[model samples]
Target: MTTPLPEQAKSIIKCCRNGQLAQLKELLSEGIDFQLFDSPLFAPLNTALKHGRWQIVRYLFKENNLPLNKKTPPIIAAAQYSKDNTTGLEIVFAHTGNTEAVDTQDRTALMTAALLGHEKKLTYLIKNATNVNATDHSGMSAFLDAVVNQSLKNCDTLLKNGADPHQITAQGDNAMTLLLQNSTPNPRLIKKLLQQQLDLNHKNNHGHTSLSISQSKHPKIYKVLQAHIEAEKQMELPIFAPSNPIEVAIQPEKNTIKQRPLNEEKTPTKSYSETADDRSSNQLQDTQSKQLSVELSSWFQAATSGNLGLLNKLKIQGLTVDEVDSKGCTALIHAAGSGNRAVASFLIQNQADIEHRSHNGSTALSSAIISNSKSVVDLLIKKQANPAAIGPGKYPYITLAAAQWNAGIVSILADAGAPVNTLDPSQLNLYHNVMLAAEYYSNIIKAKDTVRVIHHLGLDINQTDKEGNTPLHILCGAHKEKAYNADDSQIANLTHELLKLGALSNLTNKKGFTALQYAKKHHLLNTKGVIYSFMS
Candidate 1:
């Protein structure tokens, strides 16, 4: 690599940053580097165009010959800051047909416009023969972008121009499914797409059809599609007239009119409950026993979202409170995992197990701890959950959780008089737990207090594990920068506390390395010097 003239580079960068087109042109003519600002940090012309300084952008794009694509340029800027009707979009698309110009994400201008909801630009580009179906490297099509933006009109325009309705995105969502999966309601767009004959039955990557996604949120859309499907089937039936078609038509008119008047629509109006009963009867007979269970799963999912009213209604309908799902989780597990105290209390009051374990051998208590649910922890502890229970699956250890510095739950366990010195099934003890915590929490405040707590609880200060490494050895073996700034005063104070608690620090591991040797090599000058200073 060649070294650039520092002063010249500085002046050129300043010109670009300031959008001084005249100065930039003069500097370029004077042999200033044009591509010098190509670092991933910021592209010079990209910054200039982003600020709407078209003059400077033209200088860079035309004279200096800087690459306009592959960086945050005017297009992304317009999408973010420009109003929908602004000319910022026009300037962006002008640079689009340049085969030499590439987008920041290597997407075409059409994709960027659609994805970012630059509707005017998108409309112009698509009309001018910019590919409406262009996909980015991530497989996000222009139509998919419009769907993400919830831009119904833009979607209609693209679809009208032959945007592919069947194109599944990288996430395996076709346009029809993507619209329904949005958390927001887009009924107008759903109606429009249904009118275009896009399949509502098309399943996404998750094996859920558009109808399934809309089932709870947009039931109206579901009804419309279901009706359309039924209508399409009816249309496919043969429409032949009878052999005496004229005679039949003449004979039926009077009787049909007179009978219809006498019957006055005949069928009794069904109440909501009656209609529900009839539907449930048909549903039960169609699929004996399994559909009710699946419906229960849907209710449990609603419970997972903390819909207590829905849970109560389902329970009233005779859905079991203790029903285990496919993953062997109940509403209690979901509530505990989420730390939703209200839902947990509701389940507990309803006699759901507070100590239930899932398929992976994780109990509600374990899930609560992992989720950092302090309230759930308190509740479980109050309900007398066994604090000493260890996960039975692979890597079973109560101490593994301490590595994440899960302070509140650990404090709860410690308060419940659980044995702190309880080793893992592999025989590692609380010191190993503190060491792991310190390694990860080296950057957090009061992290050293954790080590002190372990020591105060009657653990060996220099305890060696099966591999023969002590906590200090592990701390010293960290990255050089980490070792340098590891707050040796904290370690000294911890050592003093250990000594006060009648623990030893001169222990050696299997490889015969002491904390002192490791500290010296890692440039932990403060810690090593303190050790010697204390000894002397």
Candidate 2:
């Protein structure tokens, strides 16, 4: 009885998956079928690329010469898988010219690489597979992805790989058009992309061409592109020339209007008056230099004026509202801490982002809490401030705010569903601080307001501090063995008040002793009696 052969295409795909080059070769020698999975096309290659099996990919491509699908290659899968195991990306592309697949999101493997600034993967794909002229479904191309992701190295690689600069987004928006649309455009990147060609009249889906778009969003980049576009137009000959010599002769005056020169040269030839003007200009420049420009860069500024008019002007000028200041605070951060409702309201109205953190990881809402301003805290929450924003001190920003004692602020933060009992990474609870505050204030009245507020809010009355002394333990030891004045009675009354409010009697102090042990150690017979009676 003869053994029937396995299906040839399945066998080849299996060999590719298993890296069985020798068996694959033997089967190929026997005239086995290659297109068994050809209905979807490149399924074997796709699987091999996904797993990043380089040897198998090399075998399928170099040895078997499998057809490489230019439109729907498996490069995206390869890039995604390569995040964990990066060895296969180079091998597959070197072996197969199949990196051209633009995925459903209009994102290609090259675009992904460029977007993340994956220089090696981008270099390999640009060199081996992807066509530079292709734009994704969203009108974004790999070049635009590079700009958005701030991958200058990827841009250089694409440009070196013969990527055409004239490729535009679906809306006819080219890289230059996008550069000008950004509030702050990178001039160097724009110049590099425009080296190939500039499509002046090419309008995107919005009916606005590169020139018009540049003119509106970013004037700095616009000036550069406008000059370049006009120069190109000037160098080209007129398309429609008058046919007759008589007609041409008659049109001289109309054609000679003073069109502005594309590139005007500045020559510095100084006369006496000019020298005086230059000195005056120098003084003005020096004066301007002495005056700190309120327009801080997107990341760092100073909080000098409490006025938010500067913030308003900044937003109008397209500065990031969440720009961190010198102290790592944003406009909203200063506004919150300053308790200036007007400034905070202005920033909120102008779309100031509420969820940004300062250098210390504190948000505007957190700053408001430290300032103890209930109004600021309320405004921030209404603007959807993130309760989880940790401050530079590494706890909830609200934990550091000033008006933290304000009942309304407490309710507002508590109602926002903020984690009330969040412990630090070191397992330190918020109750630890409460215990420490008890130690700072010997007078019951001094600590009564906050304690009462926290207690009423249902904070754990039995929670122990690092020294293992709970609130009850601290209250028992507030006065030592010496006899007290009438104020001593108030301390005793406060203790009874707290106990009635659910303070636990059995919690121990640092020495593993209960409140009774602490009272007995200090020889306070009256206090010991009260604590022991409570324990009983």
Candidate 3:
């Protein structure tokens, strides 16, 4: 009973799905309809969003003037398809001010994000005032969705944001009941719910309370619940209020002693008497400050030298773990930047701030990437540091890693939700950064690995910079540079990777020079031959 999509509409969908922004723009300029929906239940905007094509989505909204207040904003689609890169979701949320909009199923975008276990998307939605307890037609709240999907992080986030733990689903299953039915129940989740005082005696649709269900199916957890209930019943807590204010009578008295003459000899100790509290407090403060200073200095050195034992000792002595150096870099930042995994782990275990940015806007995560420390990067990411955090000069942390030609760091960042298409404040894209990497760093393997990561993230290999120079143009220019120091085989391997990623050989720069033309003009015979083969 459905009609087939027109060929033109299919082309629009194809352009959006493939992230062909230029082609899509050209089609739109020619007066192509932007509102056409295809058989897969997607319009041009939703199609781009569904595929994580962020650039195309931005173009559709910014250039095409797409309305964002529809019953289902494009953000819902973006959140549903969100992967490691949540930049698209962030963008849609920043542009569209409708976090409360629901789809036909009465499901908010937060619910969709929670159901899909997209923690970054869920965090963004909850921060933007998306009702955490808002339910769909089935009365399944975002909190319930998180529990059902076994997204422990999302559950913690929802609960911390004031989601009611006792909210029952349309199926009459509360959080406790659902948690008990999990194939493998998480002890931490049960403890957290109990700590939050979730209703232990609440019943489900089958008239079965959490205690009853646990007694039959989950005996170990049932014991935990029972113990918690008994503790609450037997504990007698007291409420203490502040004592009433007391008025003391103050009698006027004569001068206790005569003032000493200016020229008179005075004893140093007899000049003033210090109270016990004042003397002790002053000595304690001075001693603590001196001790803290010594500990912080030792801790900083220990961090850089990968001395975990000393770090732990300092932490155990009550040193501030997050204390920064003169340059405003935390001890964790120093450990991460110096590639000290052991010290970084010790600091993290001791509760250092992983998301703390330095004076220059650099974070421990960015420092780890810049140092080419994969294990440190993984550790920071595991601790939930902001992978997409921007540093000074408005450059994303991944941009710095990509520019260093550090493929291992790039892979780690990609896994931590760093977007491949991040642009710097200077309008330079990842391709540009990669090209710069190839130019400065003669390590062809590193350049190739960086390119591989960019390709894997679904970024366009043929994307041009502000100068209209494709990555091919930059590579050809690099081949001409004597300082590049890359041999013919290395250049050939780089060329092959770019070609594999669909880099166009015939694309020209702003100077009207194609890659082949640039290579031939530079008198780089080997590079010219490789370009010819790819172009032909």
Over the stretch 70-161, how does candidate 2's per-residue lDDT look in tens digits? 44556675775545344666665565556776666757887777777677777777655436757777767787888776666777666544
Task: List ranges where model 3 is wrong by over 4 Å.
Answer: 1-293, 478-489
Model 3 lDDT, full chain set: 0.70
For model 1, which pairs clash? Answer: none
The residue pairs found clashing in candidate 3 are none
Question: Using Cα atoms with residue i matched to residue i, what is each candidate's TM-score against the true structure?
Answer: 0.45, 0.39, 0.45
Worst 10 residues of 2 by lDDT: 247-256
Best of the two (1, 2) by TM-score: 1
Number of residue pairs clashing in candidate 1, backbone atoms closer than 3 angstroms, sequence gap of 3 or more or interchain:
0
Residue 234 shift from truth in candidate 2, angstroms: 69
Top-scoring candidate (lDDT): 3
